[model samples]
Target chain A: MYFENFASLVDMGGHGIYVWPTYALGLLVILYNIVSPMMARKKIVTQIRRQAKAANNRKKPASSDTGRKVNSHEQFSANGQQQASTTESSRTVNEGE
Target chain B: MNWTFFHKLGSPKWFYEISGKWLPWLAILAALMMATGLTWGLLFTPPDYLQGNSYRIIFLHVPTAFLASAIYVSMAIAGAVTLIWRIKLADMALKCMAPIGTSFCFLALLTGAIWGKPTWGTWWVWDARLTSMLILLFLYFGVIALRGAIRSATTQARACAILTLVGVVNIPIIKFSVQWWNTLHQGSTLKLTEKPSMAPEMLWPLLISIAAFYLFFTVVLIIRLRTEILDRERRTKWVRNAVEAGARS
Candidate 1:
């Protein structure tokens, strides 16, 4: 609104180079702040589920995958929550909140 | 007054649940405020006569610099709580706040440097304010590094807390550095005791932007804290129930 046109807005009377980059960097930092935590949460949630599943499997004496086999089996099932659909869980799996 | 509030705050489960309820609202408010303030400051407000268009960088620089110092002061308080009361939450807060604080501090320094090139005709100087701010950044790094050095969790918490409190001494020096010695940096634009030097149009957006940054920080902090609670309390019944139920849903 202050500037006469798009070119003037971008040019900003010759200070646009300095002004724009600072804001771009600010936006990058803000995006990082919001994103990194979500990524960490996903990693931790998946890890906890995998560990819980492995513990449950061990409690079953009749289970074929025992001792060394269980560890390898768990390693195979990285998407360990197979029964839980990915899309739904990804949306709602943040600690039932 | 009852101290039940304090005890409740100390409980991670209570904190996790309460924070979850507040997160969405805080996030929405932060988003709305940020959009309004930034757009107004960027387009509608008149440019400064002396500084021209470059003065717009103040919208980004000032809020982050404010957050940088405020977060450090907060960490020091959290450290003190950890030391005196031995509260686990306090220590966890100390741990979590470091990265966020560091990011904002880094942004402040970077933006300051960029603003400086045009304003001061140099990238940096050995001036008191700049040097003290640089020290604050290192202090943040020191707290984070000290955590990784110790193997024992308790020891790690205590060491980081002590480091944070010790580094708090830099805060006052940073505040007074402008007055204490001649510095290239100008005086504060806004002050609590006195009226702001800026015009109403510019000042309004800057104030809103500052509020937006604080809210945004809170939203991110709660998100990190909740995940931390889940990680630390994985063995507990509440966390297990929540995670399993969440997965089922």
Candidate 2:
């Protein structure tokens, strides 16, 4: 569909030297735009899944290596969540008037 | 306060979700316009009486050239949005738009050169239009390079936003350079306030081709923006839900 005949498309009114390369480069760049992002999204999903798997593995009682290193950011988030629940509990106790 | 709309706009997941619905329609319109444009330009239009069929390259050249300038304007506007509103989506839009702009600029230069050879008997000249258009390409490259060079997303966004704003001054100069100087490249074929210089038979296809390229640019930008949103929001809860849902189906 791209070219009627390889020779004709290339020859392009005898402007092949310029014409063909322009189209070729355009197609290549467009393909890169389409392909690169999908690849990056796939990589991100894989990394997240890997981390989730690690977290799940750590939760298992049989996994004796429970001391597996946790990411600092993840640890911080967990701590923040606990602190939030503790504050809620304190508020509930105060409200038990 | 229209908080629901505001919140939805802020949420990358919402954008990714909504854009998913919109992409197909954009793609279809872009494809249809492009196909019609290409067909009309390549086949329906009469060959140039002077330059012969080599002039057909105008279909590709003009659209890409227009987009080259248009993309910069869009990117600069996106940069402004990020700077004023601190919208992460705008920053991502700017980032996603860079390579697309660069490619369009490259095509414009390449096609212009090709159109040049058959018509002007040279591959390139240091015409003002040509030189500034080249500069536009370099500016796009610089933005893309700056994004990769910086490690922090916020810093990268700030730096690139400023750089894009600074480069915007070149766009008008590029557009007017032909008329201001006795450039080898001719003046604009189409303009807003004046009648088209070309015959309707030729003008019709040229118009369609321009529309097609515009649509194509939209299709590509939306795709790139969606990808950028996903990458930036990867660690967010909504992203996790979106990805897991995608993985499942």
Best by DockQ: 1
Q: Report the lDDT of model 1 for residue B55.
A: 86
C-alpha lDDT (0 to 100) for residue A91 of candidate 1:
15
Task: Name the 10 consecutive residues with the lowest summed lDDT in model 1 chain A.
Answer: A86-95
Interface RMSD of 2: 9.7
Question: What is candidate 2's lDDT per residue for B1-249, written digit by digit as tens?
Answer: 774675347555667777788778888887788778867776567667788768778888898899999999999998997787666677788988888889889989988887788789998999999999999999999999988887666678889999999999999999999999999999988988999888888888788888877887777787777766654554456655776676421
Q: Which residue segments of model 2 deviate by more than 4 Å?
A: A1-21, A61-97, B1-10, B247-249
Candidate 1 lDDT: 0.82
Instruction: Assess each prediction's global lDDT (C-alpha) against the native.
Output: 0.82, 0.74
- In Å, residue B106's CA in model 2 sits off its true spot by 0.8
Top candidate, metric lDDT: 1
Question: Compared with the true structure, what per-residue lDDT tens digits does model 1 show for residues B140-198?
Answer: 99999988777665677779999999999999998889888999998787887999999
Tens-place lDDT digits, model 1, residues A17-80: 8889999999999999999988878877787787778767776777564456545543544323
